[model samples]
Target: MKIHQLQALVASAETGSIRAAARSLGISQAAVTRSLRELEAAEQLPLLIRAPEGISFTEYGKTLLTHARLVLNQLEHAQNDLARFRGRAEGRLSVGVTPWITLTFLAETVLLFRKRMPDIQLELFESLMAVAQPLLRAGDMDFVIGQLHPSTATQEFSCEPVLNYETAVMVRRGHPRQHCRSVHELLDQDWALNFAPDGQDALIEYLFTRHGAQIEASRIVRAQSLGTLQMLVERADMCTWCPTVLQTAPLFQGQLVALALNEKFDSRQLSIVTRRNSTLGGAARCFIECLLQVIRKHARSARKEDLALFDTLTLLV
Candidate 1:
């Protein structure tokens, strides 16, 4: 099948309608239908099942769509690489970051990268680690910043550990349960949970199950936006689990408090990940270097502040 036919098929699958796909591609609906029919005939498999709601991919159609997306991504990467070689740092860099990092670290990193590579276009997609990993593997994202659990260690991506931090129960200032000394003490309190099927949610569920504590799934207020959850906790008596990095700014500002968990949860590593076998263009390389520098600077600043705090505590003691 022709490359355009494959492109049309991918667009149709994504938009779920031939008319929508044609509009996106700036082509006629008839052309889109013809291209899709030709692609299906050549493969001897129906790619889309048009229904009243929209189009759905069959099992084989799903497989073909996956490969089609990869092929298109590779072609786009090649074009970008060629453009980069002509002494221009101009190309789109799509990066995915977890919701927590989007609020905590990504803003500064993106600002620094933009200052360095002014011509390069940057797009950010915020999602949970589970969603980001597959997109990275499919070449949909050039990089992702999120937790690297044991399961991700075997993946075909290079991960650079950036931060190791404790997870704590967070609440607004003067939260009654904040003074509790044990997990059991706060067990009855309502909790706002990130309830995604993967990442920290899965790990938290596993830990709770091991402890024979039935997770209060009903009390779980699913949140995908970190800021929204923080605000909800600030206004209400709800508590949520989050990393120390998220608490640092608010804690310093006296807007939030982090209660120490009775049993220390294992530290989660924040990592910057990229495709293992893919070659990064100059702009991408520059952005990565800038990000490393920003992380190093932040880490150094945190160490200095920690040392200062220790000195003050020692003097008081």
Candidate 2:
């Protein structure tokens, strides 16, 4: 079968629909159908079983899909290697990011990279961690930056720890609960939670339940957008858990305050991730190095701040 036909088969299998596969491949539906038909005829087997809901792959189709993925991966590697050898670090690099980091560091990273590598194009997709992981494995994204859980670490992907931030309760300045130093004292307050199937909210839920505190399900306002959540916290008495990066956000200038948790809760680890076996081009490698440098700089600044705080405490004593 032709490479295009094989690619169509693989895309259709992954997406579970000809229309979606066609859209992802940037081709017409008719063309995709024609390619599938050609492949089926050449192989003399029914690759897909059409159903009312969507398409399902047959046994042969399943086997072929495994081979298709390997072939496509090798082809992509060859292309990347050739581009590198030609001294043209030019190809579309897709990146996945979380909402919090998008507001905190994504823009800065993109701007800095663009200034350095004007020829390299970038496509960014933002979503929750669950969605980002699958896309990264499917060759949809060259790399991703966000919270990395233990279950997400697999043989195909490698994660590098970038930074860790404590989850703190955030409220608007002058909040009545801001004076409270205990988690129990703030439990009655309404919370704006990031509502996702698998996200920080679930982790918070586990932590509360483990401590014999039941989270008020009704009081949890679901928010998928950080900006929207920040607005809610700014305008109302609602509070939410956030990382320290939000403290530097300009949206809620002099309005937001992060309350320390009474007992130390889990800290989220931000990680930079890429395919374990995939070879990165020069541009991607340089960009990664720059990101690591920025992280180091932030860490050094944090150490200096801590030293200053210690000095002030000594003088007060």
Candidate 3:
């Protein structure tokens, strides 16, 4: 199919109607309609369902939209590559990042990357792998720097280990169960779970299961965002399972503390995850390099007791 036809499809999907799509693309409504009709005829499938409210994608249309997004994104990368080769620093780099990176090293990495490629626009999405996977597959995001569990680290993406750190059951200081020493002790306490209950099992749930216990359904609070989770723990007297490193963040310092539990979880690796077999643009590559350098710098300055956390600093690039 032609590039404009794919563009029309994507625009229509985003804008929700032919006229809106045409307006966004700076083309006439008739031209957008013709493109969509031609695309449907070429594919021999009905891609859109027209209605009084707006247009909606058919099953076939949803399937093709993913590929269309990838094609358009790759074209943008190619153009950016050419621009960078000509020594012009301009393009957008979208990334999905977990909270730990933002709390620790993301600011330094951004500063370093900016000094080098000052004109490249950056879009940072605070997202977990479960939320980011589809966006990465559709080319709506370039890469994700987040925790990658083995179960979800499929072959569709390349996961390069960056830092290894542990998790903790955290709560506000002086909570009733702050002195509790086991995962079992906290089963009766209220919990703030940041992940979707229907998706992959949450870390907190796994810990409870490992201890041969289960949290009651009624005692759990679903926290849709990091801020909400933190607030729930600090103000609502709810406990949460999170990266141990988060205790070092400015927002959590003194406001929250990890429970002294006897159980220890295996280290969770922070990774720079990207699509396999995809070519990263110059700006993206440079930003990754900046991240690695900042990580190495952190490793160099860390105390002796903290060196073990940075042990997996092997360059997987």
Candidate 4:
């Protein structure tokens, strides 16, 4: 029930060791143990089970940890509110974003935000939409900017569409399949998949399977970072499906090109997801305004280049 006890619980669970949790919280090891004991004593239940390897959370421990994070996040927000009321420095704003959003609007937004709100701290986490969903739900993030599939965009979250675009095949310039027009030609080649979203993988599987390639079982290189993905595609024969906007990535440096595939990829809808019915703080709203502004500006700025790139990306079919 105590805030420090909840903080200890979260820190211990995340760090996987009581000593490490104490170090993270800048408290003594005994304090961490005492906090955990207090938590369990109040609930009259075992929260964590210790073992030779490390401690593992019990079912109740996991549940409490989830709430603990939520409570901590709420407290942080409250602190931010109070700080601003007292004319102190603005508070921290944590956001979860997808790579597409990162490569598209995030940098510009950060730059603009810093120019306007110099005191506000910004934290950015980039991952797949699926990975960010749990982080947002657990209150680790103020908002999430990512692609939203219809099936995964549940009613629990409110989704506001920011960008809508289909994906395209990305490859190094002068690759053999540039103008080949056949999906089959590229099937046997190794690939880089940045994220394994539900329908995203299925579309690739369906196409390869339908093309008499039977390559659905073949493992594609999974690249977690944009630079790695680009490096793999540029230095090797690997290809990837990516947003056409990715052409703007610094790693591409005009070395990579977006090719039109013979078939199609599922539609990709980029949106901002927030807890459904949650009120947005003034700072959060301001951040969204900056983000949307950047999105629009990037779209406008990329229009001419995208048109040129789209015209060049072609499959013989």
Off by over 4 Å in 4: 15-34, 51-54, 130-134, 197-203, 206-213, 248-250, 275-281, 298-317
Model 2 segments beyond 4 Å from truth? Answer: 10-74, 128-131, 154-156, 195-204, 275-281, 298-317
Pairs in steric clash, model 1: none
Using all chains and alpha carbons, the TM-scores for the candidates as numbered come to: 0.82, 0.74, 0.92, 0.81
lDDT of each: 0.71, 0.71, 0.82, 0.75
Query: Model 1, range 90-195, lDDT digits (tens) per residue?
Result: 7788888877556545678888898877887888888766667788877788778777665556567787776666667677878888777666676677777664
Please say which candidate is ahead in lDDT: 2 or 4: 4
For residues 1-317, write the lDDT of model 3, one tens digit per residue.
Answer: 99999999999999999999999999999999999999999999999999999999999999999889988888999999899889897999998988767876789999999999999999998876667777898899999997765666676778888777777888899898888999888877888875644653565457787777787777777776788888889888998888877776666767777887888777677788888877788888998999989878777766653364344333333
- Deviation of model 2 at 238, angstroms: 2.3
Candidate 1: misplaced stretches above 4 Å?
27-30, 51-54, 130-140, 152-158, 198-201, 204-207, 250-252, 274-282, 302-317
Identify the leading candidate in terms of lDDT.
3
lDDT per residue as tens, model 4, 244-271: 7667655464877777666766656667
Question: Which ranking of candidates, highest lDDT first?
Answer: 3, 4, 2, 1
> At residue 241, what lDDT does model 3 achieve?
81
Mark the 10 consecutive residues where model 3 has the least summed lDDT.
308-317
